[model samples]
Target: MKKRGGIRTAALALALSLSLSGCFFRGADELYAVPQPPKDYEALKVRLSEVIAAGGEYAAPLSGELIQTVQLQDLDGDGQKEAIAFFRFSSDEKPLKIYIFRQVGEEYEVLTVIEGAGTAINCVDYVQMDDEPYKEIVVSWQMSEQVHSLAAYSIGPGEVEELLRTDYNSYKLYDLDQDNQQELVVFRTPTDGPPQAELYDFHGVLGKTDTAPLSGGITAVADGGVQAGYLMDWVPALFAVSTYGGNGTITDIFTCRDGKLENITLDPDMGESRETVQFYTQVTGTDINNDGIMELPQPTPLVDYKITTATPNFWLIHWRQFDAQGEAHPVFTTYHNDRDGWYFILPETLGNNLTLARSDLPGGGERAVTFSYWEGDEAVEPKPFLTIYKLTGTNRVSRASLPGRFVLFPAEGLAGANDANTIYAAEFRDGWDCGLTEDEVRERFAIIKTDWLGNS
Candidate 1:
């Protein structure tokens, strides 16, 4: 989920003034003045085609590819929605057109047509600043191979005004702080240097407030999969940044403090591949300890690999707790493995309690497993469960259940189903907790074979 609270109320007022100047109408009566477009997709598409063709500026036919890109969204945040049509005129030299139409009575009327935007449009989304009623349309486009553009426009009654535009490799809208407002994060890569990331305040005239240096330079990976997501819900949201193809690798944790992006130091350091075969930089935001605050699960690494042997790999995992100072320290360590040929389930809080057991299945025939229990209280039922997951290509497939509490065993221990090395059996129990010793847990959930798999 995205963090909230970055836009300041004062800045929002200024942005509204600048964006709506001489264009926006005050009350609700102005909205119904226009006619609504036909509900049919074909009819709407044809109407948009005729409107563009009537422009009379080098009118070339719209391609099937371009015509199919039209979409409907409430760009203005009014109760009623609007249709946005994106199409190319004739040649690559001619700029792309974005036509916004509003529904009036029984017909659609052209609200505004944005011309000469760029050669190609990449993506479009709605962005709201603070508690503002209207949302601005954020458009990202490509002017050329080296020229990428991002612009935010305010759609008023019959006009669309440019709110903010910047030349960056990519852009993201997120509330870097937990204040319920959003900030614009833009990344730029120079042809000769390391990548740069800048944070901008969208409240006023789109001003840059903070900046940081990225790990890999732009174009380091052909389709560099740079990801920016929430890590913790601190006063200012703590976020993680992973470079291209580094989803399961290393991640850099950062936060915005006093208009600057500062890195939150991890004790043993993260993203180092020498200690383990694989590591995770992506931290999930969840309340694992049942404390109101969220905890960060440091990426657990898979250790000890023997490709030729039957011994399964184990997950070396750690949980990090954040102090009031925004620092994180490792609090717990556990070992887990996937034995049932199922996907590994990541450890997370189930219901109101933090789950002690978790698993990871990173594919390549590797599996991760975990066992967890939910004790009965005055309000709930006692439940025990096991989770398994396996990685299929880049996707992690998973299965979990309690069905009267069950356990899975490796194939060598079971008499029947010899072809299948994994055996699943149900164990009905009251519940379990930290008080239960490891040996007691194993005895309670018994197995005939002693050396079926390695210790979890």
Candidate 2:
């Protein structure tokens, strides 16, 4: 999902030259956001300059973590790191070339050069594919606007071997069979049929071991919704989030066992329904309880909302996880407010007799969201129990010293560029016999931060 536009060769040619010139400096008026290469990287930068000077220029990766022209890693696990650079010659017909250099006595020497076909590099990673103790390189190249090609290379002393090459829509590396070794899982969406997943393992050469049908097609794989987690009995599984171009989302679970890959959500023998989860708002799968296992979000209708209606004002998210045999086990339930970047876990005592409503503050420019008894649509009296304030600017500063209101989320790490004023506070009320108390609210309420979902 970490995609960026291709950098022009002319612009990169100058940037690469100046970035390694050893004289570029940040001015006092500048933001100083760009990072300079470390002193130890000087030798590798010099070697790169020599390669580019020969009527060639390096291109930065269009997508992936390793977007730089040069990347350093210990490919052979020999205690010393090697340098890998992506470049292309103006005179060559190929779109890209890869150069690998090994360290030798305070300098680097060329180990091998590879010819690649693609507009730009997509991703670069290393994994142990065999018992040789040396890691294999996993590189994905952008073949076109919608297609990408993946290849694995085994780098050795003066030898660079290509182990496998294939095209994929989305890819993941996981130990699907709990074998203590990694397997490559590629998801593809054919134009004529539903999407499918192909699992490959290393048997002298990387080959397809099994395949499974996905819940949805290309739209389901929107922006790379695949992830890795464990099922019941500690069995490793992959989760794919799919949307069928409607007001609903689906969670597809895939696992490998006994030499077969199965989509547990669709397998008839598992006795699980393939129904898409309908929700009024957006919902993506995540570890809501921080248990390391991803829970699928199921939208349950609110207490006062009409269950048969097509739309509901609010929803209670029931997070569920699957067992080894593809049976779902409910974990916890919460009220998720994605727009406000937070969620409140409903305690067991609260049950299903509460409802939430939002209103503007008496004064302008602030909001107060209240949770109270589930009154009917026509009821005039709502026994309010908890009121959360969304404050900004002077209101936020003044509420920090208020008496009955407790600040839940401060504006420290959740502020945006234009506005440094944001706060969520809970105002206590007296004589309301709701199952939740002030202490319980503090323990159950949480701020939603997804720093864990990096480049997935």
Candidate 3:
């Protein structure tokens, strides 16, 4: 679901060093001789130190929830905690090993030492698949950049049993069929064939119950792409934001129907705006208004500039959602300024019959944007109702000195480059009835929280 890898992998060594007091192993010198850990971790640290003395190095997981080299969790529902540790040996066929140890009086005893596949650990989590008293230990292993395998093991007293294992590009654990139980939803973007979504049931014998074709253009799932939420406040849906070519990303929504996984965006009955594709920007489905249902964004050109221009200056993004009965609903509409990184939510009274014009200010570097009326082929005879200025450096200082204008500095969180030196100043046209007062306009402005620009 929420992407957890990448940066965490690079910080593993640092994290281990900082967590040394909690029995997280460090480098070679400190590994074998753990010097006076905390009282609670003294016994576990001694056991781990003995393991390190036998030429085993503490191995932190490259990705997933289990990023630490050692974790304590009650895997067998035995009330007492068990230590699960990962290690890599210099001389071993399968270098990576997962050691499970239980507390025996003052010291910890090894319950099992399971050899793991792959060069690194992708992720690890304990999940309750069925009505079993103990949860299944689920781990995803990373062999290479494109090769990954997932395994689920059932752990009992002094034993481990492998329940299910499969190779998948990405996976989501959600209740697709609404049976009050979680099912494994696996996505595959293969090199040879079309992308597919498979639904696996782990009730008794783990098997694929349903299969559906994903978007042929989808290449790989984007980081933090998989999202599980209700569609239109009713239908259960899994929104998978995927990358295709270099700069294009699309969202493919999957819902369970008749015990089969179906990509509803591809279903012909789901209305015309089903294909949620965006270029020059990657917009994922998000619950904009905290309405429970996630809305997919579709950048619609202004009515007047629909056909004439190859490049429209501004776009009115319509945050929409699809219903089960073949209908699309617009939940929110806003002017998304990706360049300066801000959003102006359009009010109901303003509607979509407005035009936004950008003009360079007097000093060359500064610019002002104006929103006016544009209905059909005629422009409304009035001065721009709302004018927005992006002020930077000296421009920000000059505007802030102008008594009332300083209050409008930094509208909604549009703090550009240097926060102290940048401001988004909004000046509403006075004495003009644009159907909304100045206070209403200020309430709707917001900063784009997502880093759509990909700048660190």
Top of the candidates by lDDT = 3
* lDDT string, candidate 1, 1-456, tens digits: 122222111111222234343122223343222223224333444566585556522222122112224444545444445666665665445467777776554455677776655656666666675465667676767677657678877656656677777887656677766556677777676677666667877545556778876544113321122333444443444333334344333333456766676545432343221211124322333443445554455544342211233432444446565543446665444333334422222333432332333344444443434444434242453344443333233111122122432334432323332444334433323354334432333333323222212122
TM-score of each: 0.54, 0.82, 0.79
Question: Model 3: which ten-residue window has the lowest total lDDT?
Answer: 2-11
List model 2 lDDT by residue over 1-456, tens digit each. 111221111111233355544222223332122245555556656777788677556655666555655665556555545666777675677757888776565666677776778777777777876655566788887777777888888765555677788877778888887666688888877778768889888776778888988764225465356888887667788887666546555667888878799987775554323643444436666777777787777788675433345556677888888887777888888887765667888766656767777787576446776776654564455567777766776657566447887766653423331254677777765525666666777777887765422221
Error of 2 at 229 (Å): 1.5
Tell me each candidate's RMSD, in Å, in order. Answer: 13.9, 7.5, 6.8
Report the Cα lDDT for candidate 3: 0.67
> What is the clash tally of candidate 3?
0
Estimate the lDDT of model 1: 0.46
1 against 3, candidate with superior TM-score: 3
